[model samples]
Target: MALIITDECINCDVCEPECPNSAITQGEEIYEIAPDRCTECVGHYDEPQCVAVCPVDCIPKDPDHVEDEEQLMVKYDKLQAE
Candidate 1:
């Protein structure tokens, strides 16, 4: 599943660089995670780096972009190819 940065995000600036897919970015109000680019670090790490580093523990699986591990890997591969 793609991970989401919730409203609880502290905007501590830790999660952005932790995203291997470069999917996290600053929004108008707070940080945001792009569902299309989020892979939960499927190909980059054993767990989501952003989640690991977030002090607020605001990153959670996105219900709107749920996908299995295989699907996430496929997305990772496609992203890597690009």
Candidate 2:
């Protein structure tokens, strides 16, 4: 599934650089993840780098944009080609 940054985000600025897809961005209130670009690190790593580095543990799977591992991999491959 794609990830979403909750309101709990402290805007620490660490998560942005960790995203391989460059999907995370600063929003009006907090960081936002673009679902189109988020593949949960399927092609890059075993775990999501942003989740690993976020001290607040505010990053979570986007239920509204859910996708299985295989689907995520496809998205990752598409991103790599761009």
Candidate 3:
């Protein structure tokens, strides 16, 4: 699943640079992750980079877009292709 930043985000700007897919961006108030671009770091790392860097622990699995490991890999491949 793609990770999402909750309203609890402090907008510290730490997670943006850590994202390998460049999926995180500054929203109106908090940072947002593009679900289509988010592969949960499957292609690049063992774990989600954003989650690792986020101080507030606001980033969490996107319950609305759950996917298995194979699906995540496919998404990662598509992202790299683009």
The local distance difference test score of model 3 is 0.92
Query: What's the alpha carbon RMSD for model 2?
Result: 0.5
Count clashes in each candidate, considering only residues at least 3 apart in sequence or on different chains: 0, 0, 0
Clashing pairs in 1: none
Model 3, poorest ten-residue lDDT window?
51-60
- Native-vs-model 2 lDDT? 0.96
Between prediction 1 and prediction 2, the one with superior lDDT is: 2
- For each candidate in the order shown, give its overall lDDT on alpha carbons: 0.92, 0.96, 0.92
How displaced is residue 17 in candidate 2, in Å? 0.4
> How much RMSD separates candidate 1 from the native structure?
0.6
TM for candidate 2 is 0.98
Candidate 3 TM-score over all chains jointly: 0.96
Model 2 clash tally, residue pairs: 0
Instruction: Supply the TM-score for candidate 1.
Output: 0.97
Candidate 2, superposed: residue stretches over 4 Å from native = none
Query: Candidates' TM-scores?
Result: 0.97, 0.98, 0.96
Listed per candidate, the RMSD to the true structure in angstroms reads: 0.6, 0.5, 0.6
